[model samples]
Target: MQNDLFPTDAESERLRYEPFHESVEILDLYEHHRSGEMDVVMRPLGENPHATPKATMDELQSAKEAWESGERATYTISSKSDGEFVGVAEQWLEWDKRRASFGMWIREPFWGRGCSSERAGTMSYVAFEWLDLDLVSVGHDPENEQSRRAIEKYVDAYCGQHDAVLRNWLPSNDFGDPTGVHVYSILQEQWRENVTTAEIATIRVGA
Candidate 1:
């Protein structure tokens, strides 16, 4: 099912992001998932802390299927400089409302390097410019101050509004139990007004 609501590929000055496909190296993804540094990221998704090689392969396959089925837009983030796997970014589409929610987890090595903001800017470009969506939303576990800070920076840059904290909105632990999430959203109009042409130029959507 090809969905016009998602972009096949996109990139920024520092990162290249695209749907899961054959070129993605499973071993690399598995190594990253199995690393102790990724425990924090995995916990929020209720993923296995001790992810086996098979588990990583299965998850990558699942993401590829989801993208093909138009159920989600999942991108593997990589460095443009050396093509190193940086992390993953995803967008959950709500076609009826012309809205999509963003989610991402970066490798610990890439943290504090503006990768999150760059990825957000590129995805927002896809949502508004390519997908023609009305709004792009993102939320993070309340206790995740790192994510909170990263999200807030781009949300503010896009002239987005901070929505309320929705209680029990996300999985917080390995148990899959729910937790509160701080939500934010950027409307198409707001994106049009705040994201400059130069900034938009930095994101190449058809990459």
Candidate 2:
């Protein structure tokens, strides 16, 4: 019964390629390289008290480098959101050719604006068209309904489908509902008819 609702890549839809980027400011108000007044940028996907800006900045710098090159990884979320850093999103390529996985995080102040879908659509499009990739994947916990909806929109835009549900995927990880991991993905050649109508638009300060 559940299998029918959630299908594999072969039974699901794919997406056409597109280009995309998510932007953010370099600093928060205190002249710090952060994105919030509460000093919350470097925490895990869920909330935590021990987050530090110094650690996040270090990781983010490395993430930027990894993204610039066609490496085996993307970004891990290091964010605090009062619309200062605008949040983070990154994709990666692997040597195994299994599937490219993407992750996205928006500042709390700017989460509902629908940037998630737009970024995902554009990135999915790019991965399929330019990168010559096979599949794209994304995941979230069951307790995070907002994140779940965002992932749904992204996959919907890219015409992606359900992957495996990694039950109790990361019990040790701090992210809530580790047992309820939900994965979604799609392949190339499924962008016909525009299932991706993401409304979020990207704007550059100088360009």
Candidate 3:
């Protein structure tokens, strides 16, 4: 599920997406988890924000196992600028349907730099173009405006019917109680017509 797309020269030489390797340090995952920036992701999944390092490592080890078994693909979003682990992008695959769900979260310090947008765009290409998958979809907590805006660039249309209120879906935070989420998706043909042309141009210039 890994590819040769890392160390990209397109936007920033220091920023690239690479697959999650077993050798990756557990401290990195623990640090990101404890940063308090990931609550946007954790709160929605009802996960503990104060997870122990061992627990974090175990989770990453499981992800690595899943990748090896072709059940999932996860990438470490890195920054060469300071050699830091900025965030992650994951695609959950369903081979029978030839479809995947794409998700990503960037650290707060990296926000407003278009990092999420570009990486999400690249992975969308990886899913629909490189992997030849039929569809890629993503869901977000309705209150996560950052996620909503980041995902809007990839999907074809919104699914109002599929978007429903799941009571107590998101874990309570300082802001408020749990909230409902919305879903959006893009089909392969829609990506070819709507996004490929521009993405290919950008990748070519940078590749």
TM for every model, in the order presented, reads 0.91, 0.63, 0.74
Q: Quick one: how many clashes does candidate 1 have? A: 0
lDDT of 3 by residue, 38-156 (tens): 77656544455646888887778777777777777777777756767777778888889988887777777788777766776767667765668887777887767777776664453
Best by lDDT: 1
The alpha-carbon lDDT assigned to residue 147 of candidate 2 equals 77
Q: What digit string (tens of lDDT, one per residue) describes model 1 on residues 18-122?
A: 786545777867777667778866766556554687877887788877777766788989999999888889988888999989988887789999999999988
Q: Distance from true position, residue 179, model 2, in Å?
A: 5.5
| Candidate 1 local lDDT, residue 152 | 94
- Estimate candidate 3's RMSD in Å: 5.0
Ten-residue region with minimum lDDT total, candidate 3: 156-165
| TM-score: model 2 vs. ground truth | 0.63
Highest TM-score: which candidate?
A: 1
What TM-score number comes out for model 3? 0.74
lDDT ranking, high to low? 1, 3, 2
State the lDDT of candidate 2 residue by residue for 45-144, as single tens digits: 5444234655545555565555455453332122223213444456766647746787765556656776677557655654664466777888886667
lDDT values for all models: 0.82, 0.51, 0.65
